[model samples]
Target chain A: MGEIVFQKPKSLCDVPLHYCPGCTHGIVHRLVAEAIDELGIEGQTIGVASVGCSVFTLLRA
Target chain B: MADKVLMKGNEAIAEAAIMAGCRFYFGYPITPQTEVAAYMAKRMPKIGGTFLQAESEIAAINMCIGVASTGKRVMTSSSSPGISLKEEGISYMAGCDLPALIVNVERGGPGLGGIQPSQSDYFQATRGGGHGDYHLFVVAPASVQEMVSLTAHAFNVAEKYRVPAMLLADGTLGQMMEPVSIEGITVEDHDKSWALTGTDCKRKHNIINSLSLLPEELEQWNLERYKRYEKIEAEEPMWEEYMMDDADVCVVAFGIASRVSRNAIKAARAQGIKVGMIRPITLWPFPKKPLLAAADKVKSFVTVELNMGQMVEDVELATRCKRPILMANRVGGCIPTPEQVLAQIVEANKLGGAQ
Candidate 1:
């Protein structure tokens, strides 16, 4: 079997992002999650979601 | 008894909180409470704890919320105006039922009032400060020893009840030095099964949030929270009564005002005026039963505060207005003198033909 190298980051929650269209929050959030996954810091990472469009970040943490 | 070491109240609270197992502290420096953050900043790094000086009180408290959501003990400290700035975050914590200790080393306020001691935040601390019908387990410490003890106690109480707790001290208690022993401070554990720990793709994910968009769901959340509050109010009211066995006038106070009231009570007793005092340790619960019971024996009540008669209203309500309630208050960062409180006690002693 082929190695599955392009799966979703384990740090990313299995939920849909609430970002509006054209918003780069999803991209940034995915990159942040990818970084956490790459760094193996998912269990210790705590995301502080502020007000505005990023408030839903905790939902996807 | 453990040996006591002299320490400032702010540093005592910080050290006691560390002893109480608070590993995460996020705060911004505000006068009268900067020592707490400074102490945490110095000690947390050495002890493998996290200490971050946030940009603002709002951000600091929100960071507390973040750590609290993960079931770790967290705290933030501020003075009056900074506490006001963090009110929104506090309300969110209340709504989310997150357990965290919020220390308010109060200064004068109505707007950046002064860096001096004041209890003007009485209503702010006791009445939930934020825009909601929620209550923070509010503990007021009058002395540096109580500052150390209550800092530990408040953290335990917050975790036990799954509610935010505030250590409501003023600039006087914050800066005052006294012999304090943190040896007996112990942290109690509670079930944090609902905390937002990562699932590791094993069990279901826990969502630590306060957003209930449906009106019915929101109402249920508030109702459930108030049910817990009702239990807290019943079981958690703490107070100290001095010379109340046979007294004509009852003085009600807390924090620095309570410390001053004690002196006045002693002087009033010396002069045969028969004055006693009820010092509320838990300000929110207000110790209504004791005040109400005292209303039957005392001729009147005198509430001394650093604010313009804030706690006097609670005294009246708690005592059911069965006796006349007088306010001996000073605003603008002024504390009431023992002589001034004694005068109010004498006046109260004369009410209802008690003199």
Candidate 2:
């Protein structure tokens, strides 16, 4: 089989996922991170996370 | 028709709140401002609004929190002691960026103080009585007419900034009766897209909690809130100047004290002493720009208040100590007479002249 090329998006920080496997949370996170990176406002943008599973976005996102 | 009617100050404020689209009212009974609740209770339901006399001031403000989260106008009124108890909830509202109107018809205080008019709460209102670096949009109404006008304005300002606002009237302004013109005044329109009604399973859920546990996240929130404050200060500073042109002395006052200072300023000018008055309508922004401009035209400044010279600090800071500042103060539930303020103005004038 041919070698597969896969890489994590630079918009998200390199950290192990804290959410469960097949949680569908990583997909939503990547979408938002991609938007922020595309808009070039990653420096000025602020993301607020609420209680529950979203608290993991604090330092890892 | 510009109809005029005689109404007590407290009742006028309550009517103005209803006219300003305040659909939810939650407050406990306190002296001097009890008329506000009594009026709201009789009037709120008649207008298809909600009036809840909560078990305590704390409970009343928390109820206000719930209503504000729903993006509808809510209000609560209390006297000084009751306001002290409401500090926690008021700060929480600020933290949550909720829009609500809070009225403090102040009485003498320190601990269950006398039920008399006093400006002792000036520092409390201007300096974020609750907690954190929050700043309230505070309005000081000097007359019965202003009691109506400013109450309506407070709600508009509150909604615009999404910050809690205060109508900081003293006991006298709340209890006195005068002819006020509220003809055809109605609640202004507002956009409630930010309000938190359940999404009906159509949109994302909204949370109205004020808990930001991490230090860096909380710091960012505080900075964003202060950016709004800076914009408000630039756009919303309001004051009224009387006979300030070509004056050597200026008398600064607000609320009942301003009424007395006006009499004193008239008397001082009658005796050929150059005196003027500045009535601050918004207490938080503190009218520093106009006051600093006034400093250039005058050599002396004096402040009149019902407290032991609390607002004098603001005057000194505003004037930058370039001019001498004097205080005409009365405490223990008593107010300074016009003559006392005039004496201070004259005294300040002499000192400024010599220097």
Candidate 3:
């Protein structure tokens, strides 16, 4: 491997995602994060995580 | 707005709720809607929000009620069976005029229905799932994209009307993956004037409850709530119409069923059958205006549902049967295919043409 690059989407927080393979949770997570980033409310915004497979990934928001 | 991402309906709802300023989430693990709870659990803590997985559906909804009482934006989600368990709390939330988002990723029926998509909850959702003469702001999303937008809209409607709002999605819509572009909203810019966060000189302590011993007082409360509903009916009705112009027949459906019906309409039209679709975005309001308008042009109407015929009754009430109305549906976690709906439309057209 030439190089390992890690770039996080501005919409997503620096948190590990726990969704299963082929899961849409990551996509939705990015959309929400992007919406927050576009709206420029990253600091003031708060999120509520649910209890399904995505529960462990809440820290990313 | 350009980049599109594929997502499930349940996950989309969680994303939309967060973007809509939902700071509190309380829910139990339930099939078809477990992703919503899981999404919240992982995200709430990092954002300084609260997410609690209650022991049961009842505990979940009541926890929602408690958080909502504090004037914090809150939400909960479940599938058919779990939603059934949360009915009492839902009714109480309505009685208290509390604003909160409740998503029901609907599955099959009267009991512990399977984890497949179904619209059997039409009566339960639109007729007030719990006991009482009250109604909720019920929105049915047909796609994963609509799921995100509608979930955000649900929060706005609930806050504006001071009522509980529900996103009624079926298993197909909940589980299907689709591209969605989230755009044009700021979570922090929402108005918090009506929140109950310990009044500071601008207002008195807000008491949110649903108990009134006096019959007269309760009656007055009901009347007031009805007035609010009337205002909503006049201002907040939402729906979508496809190919109604010069069509001889119309199919009325919502959620996943309506999506199939849309494809059915296209197929029928390709076969020289004049068919159209009327999809109600707001199920409680029932899109009476457009349905009544379509009734005038179409000779017959076909009501498609995942359940027996719950919304068909509303269709009949709206159209007043000036034209014949037929029902086509599936039950017990079954979903009617486009071919089934197309056949119904063809039969309706044949009958109308014969007459």
| Chain A only TM-scores, each candidate in turn | 0.79, 0.76, 0.70
Off by over 4 Å in 2: A1-61, B184-191, B353-355
**Could you give the DockQ of candidate 1?**
0.26
- For candidate 1, write residues B223-263 as lDDT tens digits: 99999999999999999998899988888999999888999
Candidate 2 vs. true structure, TM-score: 0.85
Looking only at chain B, model 2 earns a TM-score of 0.97
Model number with the top lDDT: 1
Candidate numbers sorted by DockQ from highest down = 1, 2, 3
The DockQ figures for the candidates are 0.26, 0.03, 0.01
Q: Rate the local accuracy (lDDT) of all candidates.
A: 0.89, 0.87, 0.84
Tens-digit per-residue lDDT, B1-355, candidate 3: 5588988778888988888889899999878888998889888998888999999999999998878876678999999999899999999999988888889998887788688878888899999989898999999999888898888888888888888999999888888899987765444444556555653334443456566657998999999999999999999989988888878998998888888898899999999998888889999877899888887788899999998889999988898867888878999888888899999999999866322
RMSD of each: 2.9, 8.2, 16.1
Clashes of each: 0, 1, 19
Q: Pick the candidate with the highest TM-score.
A: 1
